[model samples]
Structure formats: structure tokens, C-alpha cells
Target: MTISRRILLASPVLAMATPASAQGDWPSRTIRIIVPAPGGAGTADNLARIFAQEMEKRLPQRVIIENRGGAAGNVGATAAARAAPDGYTILWTWAGTMATNPAMYSDMPFDPQRDFVPVVLLGSVPNILIVNNDFPAQSLAEFTAYAKANPGAINHGTTGNGSSMHLAAELYGQRSGTRLTHVPYAAPAAATTDLIAGRIQAMFNLVTGAQPLVTGGRARALAVLSPERVPQLPDVPTAAELGMPGLAFGTWFCLMLPRGADPAIVSRLNALANEVLADPEARRRLEGAGMALDGGGTPERLAQYLREEMASHAELVRISGAKVN
Candidate 1:
């Protein structure tokens, strides 16, 4: 064959090899999944454990989970962003870090959209609006009435600034037309301690965060944030049932990787996550803890959700005038 014909034949083969070359054998080494929250928390720990176990079974190498908490999840998220984008390090975090932090803080070292690619939406849980059992109100309606009568006299607790707990409480006040006093803490553990001690009368916190207190009669969950009552708290009504249609809210967690990671690797991670979420045993464990798996659409959908949330919460934060250092 002539030299030109030989060169043409090799061009297609070279082009085909390029993609295979770029997509090199992924998970050739151990992968680190960074949990922005501490290891003890149900959402972070559960997801990390489940995914790591399943990924180990499916992938070529082991997956490890590391806890890096502080600064409302910024410390760990920032660390994940700075890590190499070779699919070795992943950031598994809740919505507070990606959706609410930008509006609350002036300087976050990494941008949620710019610095990372969404792998999959792991799960979401409806937070319950609860108060110490000794508080005056018995239900959400009563609580609203009491707050309106007292105005800024009622102090409420939340996990921290820019958390779902914080924003949910703000939304409740905004809709109810009451200016409830907000007390922010570093984490739910501290806030729960205060709630049990009667230091704060109310909190719109995670079910897992307040489950013990509620079960033990230390606090009363008067209303849930979902449209329907959670199975765990059958007696409590939803916010929508109390004449509030637009007040539905939930806390969600997702896995994200630094931008520029290979698409093949992202796909592999998401697929492994979906399998873990689909497992009947895993689903039972998660739901038993008040969390539900949300293994849905592509990473693009998650990115869109973040953008919409950023826009939606920006307006609310401006109106609420909630600020943090």
C-alpha cells in the first residue's frame, strides 16, 4: 500500500485509542471519600459506609472515608476541592455546604459549581419543627400564635448559620409573620443539648438529630416540614396541613468531585452509589434513620438544583438579614 493510504488507516485507530488512553484504568489505587461532616452523623457515616462497601465489591480498588469537619463543612469541602482531580478524592456532603454557605459567608475558598462536579444525589430527610415538651405550645398552629403574641421573645435553636435547619426556621418565621429570635450553634449536638436543657424553646432540626430527645419525651415534634407526616412521627402534622402550602422543605446530601475529573470515573462512582441505594437492606437501614435514598438524575440536574437554591435562598437571606462571620 502507498504511504498516504497507510497513514489514513492508522488515523482512525489513533483517534479511537485517544479516548481509551485518556480514560485510563480508573480506581487503579485506593480512593478517598471525604465526608465534610463528622463520622458519627448518620447521613455522612451511612452514605460513606454503604458506598465504600459496595464500591469495593464492584471497583478494582478499595474506597476509604475520611471525616473533615468544621466551618460549616467548608473545611472539608475546601480540602476536597484542592485535592487532585484524578477521581481519587470525592466530597460527600449535605446541602448546607453547597447551597446555603455562599449566601451566609463572604469568603468560601471554593465555588460549589465551579470547583466540583456533582456525582449523585445521595439522599434527603424532612426536618421536624420541634420544641421542648415543657414549652407552652402543643402544635405548629399554637406555636405560631404564641410567637406572634410574643414577637421576638421566643428564641429558637439551629445547627448553624446557612444550614437547612436555620433556613427552615427562617422560612417558618417569614411565613408566619413572626420575628423569632435565632440562636446558631456549631453543630446539632450542642443545639440539642440546649434544647433539652430548656435553653432554647424550639428548633427545626433533623429527625436523626432530635430523634432521641423526641422519643424520650425531652422535646415535642409538633409539625414536619414535608407535605405528608413522616411514618416515624405519625401524629405530627405537616406544615402544608396547617394552611402553609409553600413551606415544604428537606435536607439533602450528595456526592461531588472536583471539576475536571474524568466523566467515566464520575459515571462509575454514580453507578456504584445507585446500586448501594437500591439495595433493600441499605434502604431499610437509611429509612429507619429517617433518611430516604434520592439516587436520581445526572450530575447536571444536581448542579441545576444548587443554582436554583442559591438564587432562592439569596432573596430569603437578604430579607431575613441573617449573617455569620
Candidate 2:
């Protein structure tokens, strides 16, 4: 598969019909996965499209992806939250939408916990520390020391205030006891351009976004803020290996249903999701794109994970002071 084709699905289902099939032949018609982001090349859209593409091949009914982008995912999330609680409408989103947006925006339209039912976690992409090759630091250890020595010398580019990228950078700074000036961008592509042109000294870029640059020699990857090394960039060290376990940062993707979805349908979808996620090809493609398919499949696990992530993101947002409105 091509690099774009090998990436993870919209963020990240289905099984058969013992009990869930009884629900008026659930999924008798088209099932739509609502991706709360713009369509095209980004992680949110590609992940959703490819995921649905794979599932569509097996499902008896058609599986389609719907893009609803704006307001940093609030627009699409609200649309999902308001959608009918039928089995057909599934919300495909990530930690930024489900976990961090609440902390960033004051008038969030939907409560991630209250308005939706957890379906399954798709995957996660860790934020790896990358610096311009021209910068002084060559390794994570040296980078931290340099940041400490020159508190405001480093300029770290991020997608925007309170974005997953910004939060990861804040977490890294907090854990490393170093300071960095924030250079927030409207999008990661622009920030990436700036990083390459020496406009910014560093970035806590997602592994998917950072891998090619590191491999192409545009940037030097120092450490991944994850528990383990990603398949796409195995040569980079992890934060734990660098003795900075507290810097662990990742943006996990998940699937959810609008509130009031039928229990039987939920069960059916969850089962199918588990089966699809466990497939070796799915794992290979997702992992190859720097996404780890280690997300817990059960709804109970997803709920607990959401709660934990929300709490962690809240703290990080407070520390970063990245309010959206």
C-alpha cells in the first residue's frame, strides 16, 4: 500500500447477528460514520475513509464516511451528538475532539460523556520531539539541557492553542523542566514548512506527520512521547528510555454512537469493530502509518480511557493556557 493508503482509519467495525442481528436486521441500509474533520489527506478523513473502505468490503450493508469539519471539530461533533441514536450513525473522532476540546472552548455543544455512547478505540499516534537539523540539540537529552540553559531560545510550532500538538509540547516542557516559546499555526502543514525553513526550532509533531521529515533528513527526531517505539520510526528513542516517562503523550482515536443507541446494535457494532481491528492487514497498515492499534475495543475500556484522558488534558490545558474563545 502507498504511504497514504497505509495510514490508520478516520480515527481508527462489525460482527454478526446472534443477538444484535435481531434488531430489525440492523444495518439493513447504509451505515454512515461521521468524521468530525475535513475530508482528504489528513488523519481524521483518511482514517475514517480507509476504515470504512475496509469494513465496507465485508459488511452486508454499505458503510460511508461523512465529513463535518469546522470549529476544531466542535461542528461535526455537535452534528453527531444531535444525530438520531440509530446504529447507522457512528462518530469517528480523536482525543483532540473528545478530550481536549472541552477544555479549550467554553461553549462546547456536546458533552462527550453525556451525549455519546462509547463504541471502540481505533488507535493512537504519539507525539515525537523533532528539532531542525540546524538546531544545536542532536538528542532528546541534549535538547532538554539546551532548553534549560536557554529558557526561551527554542520556538516550538504547533497546530494551534490547545491542540494535541500544543498539549504535547506543553507536557514535554513541564516534564523536562524547560521552557519554549509557542508558535501556534492554523495548521500542521504550515508549521511543518516553518520548521523546515528554520522559522521554528522545534516541534512536538505527531509521528505520522514527523516520520517522513525525519526520514527525508528535514528534521531530526529525538524522542517519542509514548510508551513504546512506533513501527514507522523505530530508530527514535521513547520518552521512557530517555528517563522522562512523564512526557508520555499520544492522541488516541475512538468510535462512538449518539446517545440512546440501541444496546443490541451497539453490541453488534462493537463485535464487528473488534474483528476488523484485530485483522493483521489492518494492523499492518495502521502501524505502518505510525498509528498503534493498541486501543481497547470494549466500550467499558473506552469509557474509562476517555475519563482518564479528559482529566489529563484538562490539566495540560490549564498549564498551557490555550483557550480557544
Best by TM-score: 2
Model 1 C-alpha RMSD to native: 10.1
Each model's C-alpha lDDT? Answer: 0.74, 0.82
Candidate 2: tens digits of C-alpha lDDT, residues 1-325: 0011122333212222233234667878999998888887787687777778777877888998899999888899999989877788899999889889999999889999889888887778788899998998888889989999999899999988888778988888888888999999988999999999999999998888999999999999999888878778888988889898677787788889887777677877788888878888876766766677777456776776777788889999999888888
Candidate 1, which segments miss by more than 4 Å at Cα? Answer: 1-24
Model 2, which residues run further than 4 Å from truth? 1-24
Enumerate residue pairs that collide in model 1. Answer: none
TM values, all candidates = 0.87, 0.92
- Over 114-208, each residue of candidate 1 has an lDDT whose tens digit, in order, gives 78877877667777898987899987889889999999877888766667777888788778898888898876788888888899999988766
For every model shown, the clashing-pair count is 0, 8
